[model samples]
Structure formats: structure tokens, C-alpha cells
Target: MTTSASDKQKSTEPVTKTENSETVTKYSRLPETKNSPVRRNNRRPQKSFQGSNVSGPIFQYFMTGDDAQVATTPTKKRPSLGSLSDVGSSFDGELPEQSPRKMTICEAIDEKFSPVNYSACSFTSIGLSPVKHDKDGTVRVPWTLVLEDRNIAFAGDSDTLCKYCGNVRDLDLSHNDLQSWSEIVKILKEMPHLEQLNLGQNKRLSLSYDFSTLVQSQYTNGEQSKAEKPLSNDSPSTESCPGSEVNDPQTEHDVQKKPPVSLPLTLPSAEGLRGHRDDFVHTSLKTLVLINTGAPMDTIAQMLPRLPSLEELHLSLNGYKQIENSVMKIVEPHSRVKTLYFTDNHFSDWRDFAKLGHIFPKTKNLYLACNQLPCIDISFEGVFTSLESLHLGGNKLDSWDCLDRLNELQSLKSLRIHDIPFYANYDPDPTIRRSLCIARLKNVSHLNGSAVSPDNRIDAERFLIRHYLDHHPKPQRYFELVDKYGQLEKLGEVDLSPIEQICLQLHCSEMEICKEIQVKPSITVLQLKTCVSEIIGIGLKDFNLFYKDAMMEEAFGPVGCFSELKLMSIQLSTAGLCDQSELHARTISRHHNAQRQPSR
Candidate 1:
């Protein structure tokens, strides 16, 4: 059944070797060409004992159209995936027809993008570049891809079979079923130009416990390949059947003498990642998005140092309620990270902000929305001087004291501080609150998602001045406000709590019992009445602000004529009311006359 060199030259296609060409056996033959004459011989083709191999057009293509006459090679089927059972078993009967030719990796991706939508895959925003087509019906190498929410698994190296390993710039595989971090590493190594990688929502991704299993698997594979490799063509076997040299004493001795191979006692970080044969020094990625990946603290600790070039890191929606000081210190070396997204986390203390400052020292834009912070102290305020934009919306901030700290951030130009407890409880006018915030954080250009215009700042400054004068009752404050903001054009007053709680009674037709009022001390009597009037929608003329509930002297003496009132028992009553409600204040206004209206 052996064919000679003469028979090989006549039967096989001409082979072309280049400087970089890989070594292939010249005895390999190609399928018959169209113009060749048919042979009349009854002899069957020799079936070699060699195992099946998945060759290229995908992996084993002979693309060279060389002028030099050499020889050509061949291909075969592939072995089973995962486990190898019945590997060398004979299939004498006719093989089953190749089942509808399943798609290659490139074909699957290309047809995924096909307008026909015949591919059975679900994914979004797959950006592709058509480079060239192969005879295997696969597309050419694309430079970028977005495989978010794609219910696909990682393609083996021999699969999809991209020719270019270094062209990719950005890849987003968010919300996908990429179950393993090792699989992610395999994919990233193929993309050297990658600068941004969003692996968010890959809920199953986690660092491997150890690489011992992988190392052992590779070790077993290397030995098996060596044993199965064919002997030299010049040194033909003396025995009739193949693999007959197993009985030889020399072969048996060689097997016994080989040392028991094992992995290193411990592997270095990231080097322990799969594909350990190649050196692990990839810093090309500049942006990494890891939302809801649920990476462990130890895993994060291992990865941060390995990724020194990262400029942006997004870790939102991960439910990171707390990160230890030790864990934060692990990422301190990666100071190049400029923008960080920590939204929807459960940061409960100001110490968390200090840790964030250390971990991302150069971060210019920070998103801290939807955390559990109750308060912020001035001591830690200096840590975030590098921040340009700070989003603290959806937090439990309880005082203007935190807003006052915004001024400490030298580069802060945009601030988001909505849904905060302090302002929601006391500040009735949003416009005045916004203006006050703008006036306080003078350098901020935007507040609460709106741009702070020049007019807005001027108006806000007036509100600030008036709030200062009314709340402090000090003439020095009035002089200071006038000197700084030169006669505030108009003031919008709001009864907001300056530091602590203030009590005031309200007589509303809708409610039964009156409760203590909550407003800033700086708020004047007129402002308090107006805030109550606007919130309760009562007629301003119908309500009276009285001291001691006796209705004797109007609170703040009908406004600006007196300073802010120090009411031992502040009473706000409806004029000409019935005697059903018993209070310390007496309603002396006549039935025909209205109540005393407070003025600013």
C-alpha cells in the first residue's frame, strides 16, 4: 500500500515553500483537479492509522501560488471535543453525511450581521469591518466588536480562526454568558490594540481558584502528542503493525526514566492565567468596564497591578457595599485611572470616599450616585481636589454642610446633589436652593444636571446674601454680603433649616393636628409663611403668624420692621377660625376682617 516519490509527484498538487513556510510532509496529496483523466484501477485508497485532524482553509490552507514545483499536503476530520472516546475506532461503513455543514466562527459572526437573520443567535451592536472572504464562507478579520448580551460562548483558537490577532481596539461583551475569566483572557490576548473592554453583567465570570488543573492538562497533552507522532520516513518500522515498538526494552526504560512532571509550587499573578506558554505582559487596554461582574476582592487585587495602563474603570451596579482599606490600597499603584464609575454602590461612610480617593488618585470624573452616605465631614474634603465632576445624587446626605464641602474641590465644575434629605425636608423653593448651591460652589458650571448661567449665579448670590442676613441677624453679615455681591438684584426667600430643627405650627383645613415646623433658622417669618402657603396652597391673606399662640403680637411684627422671631411657641392660625381647636393663641381678628399678612 506504500506509494513511492514518483507516484507522489504525479498525484499531488505542486508545493511552494517560502522563508516563513512551515514544514509539511511532501507525501501528502490533494484532491483530484477537474481536468485530470480518471484512472481505471480497481485498487482502493490506503487508509493510514493516523488520527483525524481538522485542517485549514480555516487552519490548514495551502494559499501559496508558487512557481517552484515541490509537493502538496492533505487534511482530515477532527477529534471530539472535551473527551476523546472511540478516538481510533474503525468506521468501515460509509460515514454519515456531514450534517448541513455547521458554520465557522467567522461565518457565524458574519451571518449574525447578515440582513437575512438566518443565524440562530441573539446579540446587539456588533460592529464589524469587512476585510476579505475565505473559501470556507467566513468573513475577513474585523478590528472591533460589541458582543453585549450575546448568548455565545468563547470560540476555540481553531474555531472562527481570525488571521489577525492584534487589530482589535475596543470590545464590549457586557451582559453575555462568558462564564469564565480564563475564557476572557484567551479572548483579550488575541486583541492587542484593545483600549476599552466592557465585561459588565457577565455574572458568572470569576477568577480561577488555581491553575494546577490547567497546567496538568497541558502536561498530559504534550506527552500524548509526543507518543503518537510518527517515526521518520527514512527509518521505516521493522514490525508489521504500527505502534509495535511498545514491547522494546529501550522504549519501556525511557518511559520509566522520565521524571514525574508537575507545575510550579505557586504561580505569579495573571501569569497563572490560562495560556501560560506566552509571556503575560499586556497593558494595551486603557479602559476596563466591570459593572456587576461580581469579581471578588482578591481577584480585583490581583488584576489591578497587572493593568497599569488602565485610564478608566467602571464598577457600577456591583453591589459593593463595602471595600476594605487593604483592598483599596491594592489599586493605588494604578493611578493612571482618570475616570471612575462607582454608581449604585452601598458606600455608607465618608471613609469610603477617602479610600476611593487613594485608589483612583488621578480620577477627574467620579460618579457616587445611589450610595448610603449619611454625612460628610470637612476633614476628608481635601482628598478630592482632583475631581472635576461629582455625582452624589440618590444619597442620604442630610445637611448643606456636605454641599459646602464642594467648594473644597478646586477642579469641580459640575455637581449633582439631588434627592438629598436636608434640602428635601426644609428648602421649599428649588430655584432658590439651586441658586444657593451655585453661589456656594462658585466655580461649578452645572448643578443638578442644569447649566448654571450668569443670571442664575447672580440670583443665587442674592438668595445667599438674604439667607445670610436673615439667618444670622448680624449687621456684620449684611455688610459682608453687600460688599461681596454688590446689591443682589432680587432675592428669592425659602424657609430652609440652616443648621438644626425649628418648630412652627400650621392650621390647615385638610389636617387635624398641627405639627412642629422644619426650616432653616436663617429663614425669615415672611419666608416661613410663604413656604407654608405655597406647600399647603392656603390663601396668604387668611393665615396669621403669631407668637405664644395668644395671637397678641404678630410674629416678626408683620415682617421687616423686626428681626427674625424667637418664638417660644410659634403659632400659625387661620383668622376667624372656630373654637374647636384649643391652642395658647387666641383668634382676635373679627369675622369681617382678614388676618395680618407678613411681608419680607
Candidate 2:
């Protein structure tokens, strides 16, 4: 079911290749072209070779010549061992000597010297036994064996004929040492019905031929007869023209045609993906999957345009550094491709993704995880209008500006931002906290206006917590103080031991938590209510001033009010226990005396 040159050209109808050969032509097709004749006719059939009844020795013959002069050896069909006679003549008819009655299909297939040569026959479909082994002792069931348009699968490497195979629509040759694309091409050339080919995990083969040059050369040669014209009156005689044996000028001029470019048949690299750029142009290959093979980007870019009906591409783990911009440029011209997956690569920038909207405008799912993207800047709104699922987890992004831009993508159904930085800086001052809260609230409100549900707030909170945990020092002491005071009783009820230990070790409080409480006056009140019982000797006025000094020190240290208050509190707390009661009354007097005492 291979496509003839004429059929291929006709399939790309409305696309004309000029005879000059100076420019390469481009063509586009509607999505409905999947049902085109070129596709249907070029599909390869399945193969199968199985039977229940063990028929007696049967002979099959294939005739090719019109006169029938040649007669190759007829294929021998042996019956199952169970159906064979127990007493078979091994030496002479009188002896009735018998070895094992007959060989099973497995035994027949395993015999290296068996006269069975199934490869010579072209069947449409074949089914093989799974227990069959090849000559090399490798399990050799046709992962996908095609005889003409038929596809056949053997359980094992059995010498079975595909009896009822039709045109092969798909072929799978996944695990074999079929090292050459030429071998594959030869096999495909035999099965003209082949439409889909799976050659995955075959490290040695490649689809690298420049098929366009071959097609063009053939086309130019075919057009030679039509391109011929009469020579001018002043032209040299026919005999003077190169390669002309006659004196007629007309025939001499006709012989002078420029030779077409001869591209090498073999690919440059051992992978053999080089000439595929041309193959797609000249053939009817609608789908191609090359996963894990280190095919160069330049080769992929050049080949993309030729596959007009290509709808899906899976190119994962290819060690790509950057998404080839040329890939975007090439695919931009194609409206048929719908899905593309390039996960676990080294794509570091989002700008490369910006091209997706322009190229695969109708792409629905895009997966880009485990990449080296520090930040993404996708400002183009409505770029992913048709995109439904986007997986961008495991990236390093400290901001949400990219997500903000994606708010306009109304079609996005699932968005994954796993393992991303979620929190920013926080200040303890009430005013600053209030400002920061208001700003974040505004951003959240903007996001809420988009298609994202209210539940996203929980995700946002988790993100913020993760970010704070990664950046801020331990605030365990704060939690411990709250626990001792029975403040934030609900929070304290749950074990605060872990946080307390962490805080005690670091001796630092997380400013973010305080800022969160300060922004919401209700939270401040809750804190005060929880800690009231713990403030036995601490006066409300002193606690208030102490909090104010702490806030001031956090905001503006040394020259602030908290600096002087901290010194006074330290001296008061350090005074003798017997004089502690008098210290409060003398505290103000001492301050006055100290001011009056000296400037030093």
C-alpha cells in the first residue's frame, strides 16, 4: 500500500512545484484530510498465521510471470504432531520405524534448516505464536510483521503464513536490532498499505533521508518531455549540441537540461533522522514519534513542515537546552497539530513558550515540568485560549506575574504550580502590615475574578507558608510564648512542641506571623486574650510600651523610642529583689537625676 510518486503529488494538490527548482513550495490542508485517498491507500495491513486443525501436508504456490515458465519450490505445510500417524516409516516400509510423529508449529519454526521461508511470501495479515524464537535464539514473534498490507503478530518466532491479512494500517517493530532505516524503508516499500510505523527503542535506525530532493528530481525528470521546446532560428545545428548525434538543432537543444541536485541517500549521523525533512514532504506520513533519541533540533525543524497531517508529537527526555525557536516558526504554519509534550528538558525561559500560542493555536495540553526556568514572563493574554491542561510544576519562580497574565486564559481547566516559592517579605509595623495585606488582597481579588475557584485561596495560603518557611528564621519562641500564656488556645491545643524547640534553638521570631496578626485587629485581640494570664507582673502599660519599642526597633533601630525603652526595662529587671518594689517609684526620679547629673 505504498504511495506512488504520482499519488503523493496528487495528495498535495493545489501545491505546484515550479520547474525552475529554485524555490521549495509549501502547502496546507484541512483537518478532514485524514480521510483522504492518499492516507487510506497507503495504510499497511496487519499480519497473522494461526490455525486450529492440523491439516495434512499442503502446498502453496505464488506465480508471477505471464507465461508461467518459472516454478519455484512449493511451500510445505506440516501437520501438528498429534495428527500424525504413530507408525511412520523411518527406514523402510517393512520396518515401520517411527521418530516423533510430527513437529509442532513451534518446533517447525525453531528448526534452522527447515525449508520454510515465510519471508518470501507477501500476505496481508499474520498472527504468530508467542513461544516462537528466531535464528539468533531471540524471541522473534513479529512485534508487527507486515506481509503486503496485512499485519501479523506471532506469539513466538514461528514460521507461519499470514492467511487472512488485509492492508496494514499500523506496524510495530519496537524491540529489534533492525539497524538501518533502509531496511525499514525496504520493508515499507513492499507494504504499500503502511500508514503508521513504530520504530521506538531501535537505537541504530533513523528516518533521515532528504526525500524532497528525490521527489523533486523524479518530478523534473517526468516533466522533461513536456518542457521541451523548439530551438531558436539562430541556434547551433543539432549535431553541435551536446550529446546530439543528429544535425537537427531542435533535438540538440532538447538534450541540454540541467541536472538536478543529488542529495546523499545515507544520513550524516548514525541516527538516520537527517533526510526525514524531505521524506515527509514527498510521502504521506501523518504521525511520527521519536522519544529519547537525540535527534538534532535543526533536523526536526526542517522536517516539521513536510508532515501536514501530523497531529501529535512526543519528544520527551531529548536533552534539549532550549526549545528551538525554529520549531515554533515551522509549526506556526501548521494548523493540524493539537498536542505536544516536551517534559524533563532544559528549557529555562518562558519566552520560548510564548510561541506556542502562535504556532499550535489549538493545542489543548502542554506539559513542561522539571525544567530550569527561574521565572516566566508570559504577558500575551489569551495566548492559550484553547489550552485546557498545563503542567508547569517543579520550577523556580518567586513571583506570580506569569500566573497573573494567565488569568485571561479562560479555557484553562487544570493548572499545576507545584513546588514553587509562594511567600514574600513581611514587616511587623502595623501600618506596613496593613499595606502589605491590602496589596495582597487586591492581587487575590484580581485572581478571584478569573476562572480560578475560591478554593484557590487555600492553595495560595499553602504557597505563602512554604515560602516563609524557606526564607524566614525559626519563630518557635513566639509559638512557645503563646502556648505558655494559653494565648491562641486553639493553636496551642495542637502540639506546639516542634515549633517551640525550633524557636528556642534559633532564638528568633518570624516577623511574618506578627505582621499577619497586626494587619487584622481581630487577630491582635485574640493574641492579647490568650496571653493575658501569662502577664502576672507585667503591667498592661509596660507591655504596650514594650510592644511599641519592639515594633519600633524592628522598623527603625537605635534612634527609635524602643532603643531607650529597652535600656530602661533591662536596668529595672536587673535591680535587686528587695529594692524591686521601690525601683518603680525611683525609676522616674533616677531618670531625672541621671539627666541632671552629667552630659556624659
Candidate 3:
């Protein structure tokens, strides 16, 4: 085959053409198209691509002669950009930009809490079961939002939260990916009326940042609601109240110059505060549950001042070994919390509890259940002066001295000390253990949630008095009750010998027939009824069995078939009686003679 003069002058590449098809035999150029004019060879091009980056075919040619093409190296075609329908205008094919898919807190809330996801009385979300509520039930409003295990990491914007969850009162953000206090504050500062917050089981959470500085930064950026500016001289004035700020000229200038000083004064309303206090304080949050969040004492101390209005603080399951001494120095700002739950922790020393009472001086109710407390210390008696209720269940306390020390809590009204070694090993019976607690604590009106009535108090005190009658070094409460009840006599020894036989009297006033029967102690009421059936000549179901007490004069009927008849005090009646299950038959002494029928 022959090539054109232009192709020969352009390149030395081999060209071969066959009669059947103009094709290269081996390593030769084929017939190029008539429109192809660009030269092609094995050599790579050195020209740089310098255009608007619009992608198309790599090689273009305009041929003028026979349809013969040169052998060119194969180049990988660039991957096509996927559909960009969502990308408005800025995204071009050049930079290969990719937007991250991380979910923000507001998007999570919206996706999980939108109206379309709600049914008649329930709402559903991803990776969670549906939350249900009733119109007229305890949950009258959707004021609580639980976003536990939602994998939320970033706080996007407060404006979105304000639009959706503006009135939210309780928020549960447990088991999420919130890494810092700033993210939590970003979310909390939007809810002006939030009351309870549960951040349980979150990993890598820290609340130890300077909250005052955070609040100041948020306010400086105008991200937080601007504090109400002081009334200008030109503004109309209302009636002045007592203790209102006096407009002194120097103080006015100072307030105008120092914007930080005026921030607290401007937050007079709940909406104004937005949990943004200058001194690391939140006014509306009353309960904070931080169970198993791995927060330490330093973190707690740092957060306490921020939660000034927090009344119930649940710090359970955090593996706290002891209260840090640093807590002692930081107690002044956090002492007003009234209820604290430190249950399921690792604290064993009562000195730590003493430190708790010192840290929270006004704590009224304390729950330290499921801990490893071994004993109560003397220091504990005086520290919890205002404590009204205490729960020490599931502890290691084994000594009676702990009980005595607990009695020193003058304001203590209710006490729970179950599952302790002292009771589990010594008493074993819950009834006796409860009586012992009621008898020991003088001011305690409730023991393990049951009220201590006057009769219960008397019986418990007498039992306690007899309990320690012969024991050496009796409890101090024993002496106190002994003085009140006047040295009660020791209980007589109980005769526990089983009876071999019992004598029962049977009388039917309608038939004027009276008889005396002797039966073995092992006979049940059903066997006694069968024996009576043979005597009275009546079927077992025709007449009901009743036994009337001779001393108490109270009649009981419909006795249980399996009850032993040996201990029953028997008197006869002919008429049918009502159910008297409450009245039980008591054993009569052998000396009491039955009124037998005279000889007919």
C-alpha cells in the first residue's frame, strides 16, 4: 500500500492497506477518515490542557485524503461526573469538591421530630422505637424530646431549634457523640425554659470549660439574645419599686462602659436569661441526670456553679471512689442542691458521705443505694442536719453502731436500710428487721416507706426491749424505751410442744343435741367435717362449719379445708353466718370446761 505525500512528509510510521479492507498488517496505521487532518503517532503529547475544563474526547482530527488512521496509544477515559441536579451553580467539574454528610443537631431533631413522622399518638425516628403519648394522659403536651442514641455531634444553629423546640422543658441526649461543653451549651442556650436534662452514657463528654467565658463569647458575637439595654433618660418611666437601681451618675457611666457588668441585671425574665449567666449559672434547669458519663469530681465541681438552680443531681454509676478534697473548697456555690442520688457507685467510706453533706448542706433527701459503704462514721451524724430521708439499701454496713448514728439525724423522717449485712445476716426476717429500725430511730415516722403507727411503735419498742434484754452492752434506745415503758418484765418462755389431741364441743341448737368429740392433732378441718357429718346424719355440703370463740364471743365460718382443727376454739351455731375470714380460731387452754348438755 502507498500513503499520501502529506502522510509521508508528516511521519515515518508504517502504513499497510489490503484490497479487501484497508487495514494495517502489523504495527502500521489504518486508513484514516476523510475529515481527519490531525497527525497521530505513538509519541505522547506535551501540550498542556488550558481551557474551561469541559471534558470530551481526547483526540480530534480533520482528514483530507484516504480513510487511513495511525496507531495511537490508549488513554483512560475520565470518569463522568455524576448527576449534579442538587448542586445549584458553584460546583464545576474542575475542583472535584465534596460536601460532608455529617448530621447536625438541628437536622437530627427535625428529621426525627417532624410532623410527618408523627402518627395519631406516637412518633418514630431512625435507630429507635416509636415514642407514644395520649391526648388526655399524663403527657398533655410534647414538651419533652428524647434524642438518645441519635449519633448527633455538631450543634448547627439555635434559630432552627427555636423554631421547633422553643417550648421544650425536658431533653434526653443520652449515648450521643457530643464531645465538649460548648456544643451542649449551644443547644441548651436556645431552650429558655428547659427544666430537666439527661446526658447519660455519652462518651468523651466534658463540662470543665470556663462557662463564664463561653457565655461572654456567645453574647459578644450576638449569637445569644442581646441583654436588655438599660432604660434611656428619654424613655418613659414606671413607678419605682424598693431596692430598684438608683440612677447615680457615676454608676450609670460605669454600667455604660462595662457591658459585662450589666448583663446579669438585664436578664430579669426567663426568656431573657436563656441559660446565659455571667457567673456560670442556669436558672431554669432543676434536675440533671449524668449517669455513667464518666465525669470526675473536678468536672462535677466545675459544672455545679453552672447549674445553680439544680435541685436533683443524679451522679450514679460513675464509679466514683471518693469525694475529692477539692470539692470542700468549691462547696459555697453548689450547696443549695436539695436531693442527690449517688447510687450504684463505688464509694465505700462514710467520710465521703460526710463530705457530701458538707458540699450540699441543704440536701433534704439522699439516695446512696447499691454502693459499697461498709459502715457509718460519727462524722456523718452531725453533717446531714437537714436531711429528711436516707436510703442505704444494698450496702456493706454490718454494725449496729451505724443504726445508732443514723438515729442522730433529728430531722430524718424516713429511712431505708435494706439488703445490708447487719439485717441480711443477723435478722433475716424483713418484719423483725423493720421493727428493729423503727424502734432504733426515735424521730423516724416511716421505715422503708411504711408509716409507723402508735401501736406499731409500742410493739416495736417492746420487741426491741426484749430483743436486747439479756445481751451485754445493749443499744441506747433500749434504755430510753425501758424508761418510758417502765422496765417491762422479760417475756415468759413460749411453750412450743405440739399437741397430741384436742377436745372439741359440737352443738346444734335447732336439734337440741350436744356432743363432745376428741380428735388427733393431725386432723384437718375437712376430716373433722366428715366426722361431724356422720354424727349429724347430714351431707358435707348441706351445712357449713363454724367455730365461735368462747372468750372473745366472735363467730367465724367458712374455715379453710386444709386448716388444722387441733388449735381451733370450737363453739356451735345452727343458723348460717356470713364470711368471717379475718377472725382466726385460737387454741383454748385445757383448764376451760365446755358447757356439756345435761342428762336427758
Candidate 4:
């Protein structure tokens, strides 16, 4: 394209305008040069201008980025959970053992509750208040910490933990990866004021494992060494120690000639348990939850004495089918524990469960729900002397005899026994189920969480009486109730069909009329009057009706329009007439006159 000299000069100069009363400068296209286009290097030199944003500054360096000596900004470093140093775990030249996938409780606590994030931590026990300065100007920390489901394997240094959460009272470390009971004891020993501790779902923390280790050490040093030195036929096989002894019964002379047989393993002495118990003392812990922690009766035996002030213990879903005799002998009678929860367990035998009564003699509340208990042992009496509440729901009990045996517990006032086969066979209605249970448990004032009043008891006992009245044999309690409140009469059969019908006898003293009518009891008073007028040929306004019930009174005064006629004898009388004789005479005279006149 050809350009004129004047047009070229105008294009090179800047164009200006006024916008919204502000001076604005516009740029025209620059003329091309031979070596390179006209460009401004922002890195070398800069020019400042003051004008409106109708045309913004267009710099050349912004299009093609600068490489050397670029203006740099420093980055801030974030704090992290350091290795085993914080927890006092020292390996001189090697790394302390830990799972790469899981974090220690100390590591998790440090990461979640660092000083920088103190304002964010929810301090639950102290009204969920965030971190704040106290009157003394020291920062107040949380009293409750929840580190559940954090894959925490180790408990960290007790001293270090106390420095951070020293005031923690209710700590929930449940659903973690803690496996060592020693690690738990470390945490408990540090927190003297800890009232509630939840360590549920840490399935590997078993005291029995430690006991087994002790037994193995003793066997290796004593019996194993002796067997290896002797190498004789008398040496016992670990697989079937009892079987080998039974198979090779020794006579008197043979017994004297050979050494006495002994098993390869031996139960830990009470002295050894005492030493272990001394390691787990926590006087202020009132509630300890170790559900599904693989802890058995031995673990419980080890813990009960240490936590002398603990009133509630939950050890559910630990595969506790039976209580070992050795463990029972080891556990001292703990009267401090008032409540115990052993639900969702493997307790099938009543005798096995009865051992708990001896272990915790004064436990008032006991929950054994969701077990395979076939029946309660009637013979196990005088054991649960202090038990007031018993929960036996979701069991395999199918007989009333099992419930009758519960009468042995004189102190049992609350009983929860639903979802059992015994009650399920009667009916699905909760009322009937509760009635049956109440009837069976005579002393229970609370059944399935509902308070059973005296009237309810009487009704339940009467229901039980009628329930078993047809059978050839009756329960012992039935005869007892009969003696207490005479023999209850059989209840009448009720009509259960839709729209029930009743037979009512209608009597009229003024007209000397008597008739029986079948009608629905649900009809209103006006509808009832219409029915009586149509059925008995009586006018609606001629007589006033009165009802007499055999159960209540001889006769109720003239029934009103709003009065009900449900299952009652109806009597009709002349309206506004006091004397019955005059009314009858008038009716008879009218009837005679009608007969004499004949049909018109």
C-alpha cells in the first residue's frame, strides 16, 4: 500500500482525547525499521506516565519473558512431624522400627495439634473452646483429644505427650493400630486424671500374648533344655501332652521307677501377674473401653486390679467363648466395677458367663446381648447378688424356664430380654412380648426399658394365667398369683371382624313393648334414634331413652342426643311423664280404641 508523507507524520505522533472529563492518550501504529521493530526494553530502562485506562501501557518485555536475574520471592517452610526423636525412641546407628504406612500416636498428635494450629483444635471437654490465653497469659490447651482411626501404632513418649495434652480427661484413641498393651499403659500412666479411655478396634492388644511369651521363655530355659539333655521316651510331645500321658498309663511300680510326667507349658504364677498388674495402675480412670481388642478373661484379670476405681468396663467382640479356670483363679473379686458390657461376644454356655459374677461380684449393670446363650443356668444362684440390670437381648433362649430361673437374682429389677426365640413364637406385638417377660420375671420393675407399674404387673400376671389356663400343667407363678389375687376368670372371646355388631335388647315401659335388635355400635346417637324408630314403630319424640349396663349401674338417667349406645341395654319411657302406670293406661286405651274402630 502507498502512504502519503502527511499521513505517515500523523500516524507517528500520539493521538489524545477526553473521556469522562479525564485526559486519555491513544497510540498509533509504529513505523517499521530496517534492523528490528521499535521496542522498549523494560529490564534496562522504564518510563512513567499518568493518564486514564482508555489505553493501558503495552510493554515489550511482558510479551517475551526475562530469563536472567528474574525478581525472586522466598518461600516459607512448614513444620512437620519429625521422626522417633520426639517420642524418645533412640536407635544409636539404625532407624527405630515402624510401619511406613502408619504413623505413631505422637506423630499424629504433633501433626494435628501443632502450636501453629492450636487455634483450630476443638477443645471438647472444655466447652469446645479453641486455644486461647488464660488470665495468667499462658495458652490453655484442650482437655479432650480424639485421635480415632489415625493408624496410630505407637503411643509415643509419655512425658512429651503430657507436655502437649496434659489436661486431657476424655481421650478417644479407638480404631487405631496400637497393638502393645505396654504402649497403652504408657498413655494411662501419664494421664492420671483421664476418666474415659476408648481403645476399641485395636485388635492386637492382648495381655495373653505377653503371658504366652513369658511361658515360652520359662519352657525354653527349663523343660526344653531338660528334654534336649535327656533324650528319652519319657519326654512328652507338645502337640498332645494329655493324649500321650493317657495312652501310656503307668502302674504304681512304673510310676515310682520313672520321673513324674509334666506338661511342656505351665500357668504363670500369681506373683508374676502381680508384677504385671503393678505396671498398669490408673486410680482415676472410671471407664475403660477395649472392644474387639482381642483381650480375653486373662487380660481382664490383669486390668481389673490395676484400675481400682474403674466403675465401667467394656470388652465386647473379643471372641470370649469361655472363661479359663486359671484366669478366674487369678482375678481377684473386684467390687468397684458397677457396669460391664460384654455384648457381641462368643459366650454360648451359661456357666461360662456366670464366672463374670464371681469376678466382678458387685457389678450392678451387666450387658450380655448378642451372644449365643442357649439358656441361663438355674443352678447358678447366689452369684449375681448385686446385679440389678441384665440385658439378654438377641440371644438363643427359647424357653420360659430360662427366664423363670432369673428369679434367683433377688436384686435384678431391670431386665431386657427381647429378640429371643421364646418371645418371638408368641407374637410379634411388643405388648405381648413384654407381658410374657414381665409375667416370668416377677421382681423386675423395668422390662425392655419401660417401667412396669403395679397395675401392669397384675394385668401381666392375669394374662399369663389365662394364657396357660388351657394347658394340662401350669407354672408355679400362676398358682402364686392365683393365691395372691384369687383365680382370675377366663377373658371373653372378642369379635375381631371389621365393623363389629352387637345385640341390644330394647324395652319400653310406657308402650309395654320388648324387642331385640342387631346393630353396629359405631353409629351416632341420632342414627341410633332413627334405627329404633324404624325397628320398634316408635316415634322419635314420643319417648326418652335410658341405658342400663350390667357392669356399671341398674339404670342411667334419660340418655341425651350425644350419649353413646355401646354394648348397653336400652329402656324407653314416655317423655315428661313421671308415673309409669298412667302412661301405660293411656297407651292401652289408645290401642283398644284403635282395635274397636277397626280399619278406616
Evaluated at residue 347, the lDDT of candidate 4 is 88
- Model 2, 1-600: lDDT tens per residue? 786878766754434355676333333331234443222232322212222222112212222223211113334453442322332213434543223332222233233222243434223222223334333322333333422211111111111221111234465554333323333433443333445665555444333433333334333433422211222222222222112222456745664563555554432221243354423231344445555555556556555554555677666666777756555543434566677777778878777676656766777777777777775565657576677777777767665455545555777666665555542333445344332222233223322123433555444433334333444453333333334433331212465432111010101122111211112122233333234313323333323222323355567874562222233233222321111121010012345656777665
Candidate order, TM-score descending: 4, 3, 1, 2
* Candidate with maximal TM-score: 4
- Best model per lDDT: 4
Model 4 spans with C-alpha error above 4 angstroms: 1-101, 115-140, 206-279, 427-429, 491-600
After TM-score superposition, the amount by which residue 318's alpha carbon in candidate 2 deviates from its true location, in angstroms, is 1.2
Tell me the lDDT of candidate 1: 0.55
TM-score of every prediction relative to native: 0.51, 0.38, 0.55, 0.57
Each prediction's whole-model lDDT (CA)? 0.55, 0.41, 0.60, 0.62
lDDT of 3 by residue, 274-314 (tens): 44454335668899888888776776765676566889998
Candidate 1 residues lying further than 4 Å off, grouped into runs, are 1-131, 134-139, 158-165, 206-277, 472-600
Model 4 agreement with the true structure over 216-313: per-residue lDDT tens digits: 43323223222112222322232111111222345444544654444566444444444553334577889999888878677668666667889999
RMSD for all candidates, in order, please. Answer: 20.3, 27.3, 21.9, 19.8
Q: Where does candidate 2 stray beyond 4 Å?
A: 1-166, 175-196, 204-209, 220-287, 324-332, 421-600
Residues 1-600, candidate 1, lDDT per residue (tens digit)?
998888867766434454456433433334354654333332322221121121112222212322222222333333232222222122347653321222222333433343222222111222332444455443344567665544433433422333333466777777655545555555565565778888888776544323323334444423522212222221123221111222458856776676766555433455344345543336788988888877765566556655768888888887787877656544434578788999998889887787778767778999999989887774645576678899999999987766666667788998898788988887698876776677777689988779988888777667777677546453343454588867654455687833344455555444343654565555455666677666555565654543342243354453323222334233322232222322221223455464444546
